[model samples]
Target: MSKFAKAGVAKKVMDEARKPQNQQKIKSAISNFTNKNKGGGTGAKPR
Candidate 1:
């Protein structure tokens, strides 16, 4: 949906894509996985 020819449609699509529920679900899933993997050396500095 290119905004050049259809601004309203593009705006609607982008708005839906940026919804709170969708963003929260994505962030929650990432955090859940990250917490599960919190341990020795997933992203830690070597000693």
Candidate 2:
């Protein structure tokens, strides 16, 4: 997946992690996926 997908997944995961019905795995995995690939990749690269 791309960096954007990573960020999006992180947000959704964190939101789910806040709920009590969610598993502890979600909470633990939060730190693993969140902010790991944040950067200015949203723009086109200069070639």
Candidate 3:
């Protein structure tokens, strides 16, 4: 897409993310994602 179209999309996203309800939803979604991935391990095996 063109720069103008990209700018419009970015503006719309920023507008949505600025709302209190959307902000709470975003925070919860991020926290849930992190909570689910907290037990990740490295690829190396134990010696």
Best by TM-score: 3
lDDT for 13 (candidate 3)? 100
Error of 2 at 19 (Å): 0.9
Range of the 10 consecutive residues with the lowest summed lDDT in candidate 1: 38-47
Which candidate wins on lDDT?
3
What is the clash count for each candidate, in the order shown?
0, 0, 0
Off by over 4 Å in 2: 23-47
lDDT tens digits by residue: candidate 3, 1-47: 99999999999999999999999999999999887767567445658
Provide TM-scores for the models: 0.42, 0.42, 0.76
Error of 2 at 13 (Å): 0.6
Question: Which digits, one per residue and each the tens of the lDDT, describe model 1 over residues 1-47?
Answer: 56576988788778876999888887898999988788666676767
Cα lDDT computed for each candidate against the true fold: 0.81, 0.75, 0.91
Worst window of 10 by summed lDDT in candidate 3: 37-46
Off by over 4 Å in 3: 40-47
- Candidate 1 clashing pairs, residues 3+ apart or interchain: none
Model 2 C-alpha lDDT per residue in residues 1-47, reported as the tens digit of each score:
99999999999978987887686676567766664545458656869
What's the residue-level lDDT of 29 in candidate 1?
89
